[model samples]
Target: MQSNTVDVFTIGFTQSNAERFFNRLEKAGVRTVIDVRLHNTSQLAAFAKADDLAFFLQKINNIRYVHQPLLAPTDAMLKAYKKEKGDWGVYEGRFLDLMGERKIEQRLKPEMFEGACLLCSEALPHHCHRRLVCEYLNDKWNGALSVRHL
Candidate 1:
């Protein structure tokens, strides 16, 4: 099936409090939350911890929460970026390769983006894997979906 346009949103909660974070998603009318973090259960997540976030999404707005760990960068890859001060270009290339190897483009259901949002921990899309994921998807999916970074 071909979609005229798929609205895939992206967001991160680093600089946001729980209320504002969830509020943004709610206001956007997000029906699904695709957690693209390697460690969704980290204590640093506050209210966005795996179980709690899933609970809250359903309880607050009937939004579905999905943990797509495969979408996350590997620990080694992330270490190279943060701990080793790796070049953004290198990181981007590596991450893109990983996504292709995972065949995520083929596996992803276009219907899922009807009212779905991609999630990560960064405050903004710059230098974030979430942004790369959206860009890759937008291109590979033949522009069926346009990403809106929230």
Candidate 2:
């Protein structure tokens, strides 16, 4: 690990199977998985259910799992984007504002993100808050964080 560089990874479980997901994390040498999902307990993905994911992560790869709801968008915000067909630009603006208002950069420790993977439901980071979170933190920390999407 570089003294001045903090490496962070991001991933989405959607369109991924248990084998591929776990293997990817293991291959990436992830030490922890920080779930950034608003509704993690949903039945959408059985293996990704909060309890099951934690258990699987530990049992399969010995990786620590944490659910950090503060990293997720609010239910209303998500609803507007998904259910109401709101524009991505609007959603992005609102989410970024909310993160600033919540002061996640101050509340979340940079050390915790070292060797950690941010987990979301999107198959790709393009439209995911996980990507925005990484960019936001990198900006706040003066590009100290090196983010890699897996």
TM-score top scorer: 2
Q: Among all windows of ten consecutive residues in candidate 2, which has the lowest summed lDDT?
A: 1-10
Error of 1 at 129 (Å): 0.9
Model 2 whole-model lDDT (C-alpha atoms): 0.93
lDDT of 2 by residue, 37-78 (tens): 989987778999999999999999999999999999999999
Give a tens-digit lDDT track for model 1, residues 1-150: 345888888999888998889889999889999999998987776788999999999998899999999899999998999899999999999999999999888998667788899999889999999998888877887777767888
Q: Number of clashes in every candidate structure?
A: 0, 0
Runs in model 1 deviating more than 4 A are 1-3
Q: Candidate 1: worst 10 consecutive residues by lDDT?
A: 1-10
For model 1, which pairs clash?
none
- Positional deviation of 62 in candidate 1, in angstroms? 1.4
Q: How does model 2 score by TM-score?
A: 0.97
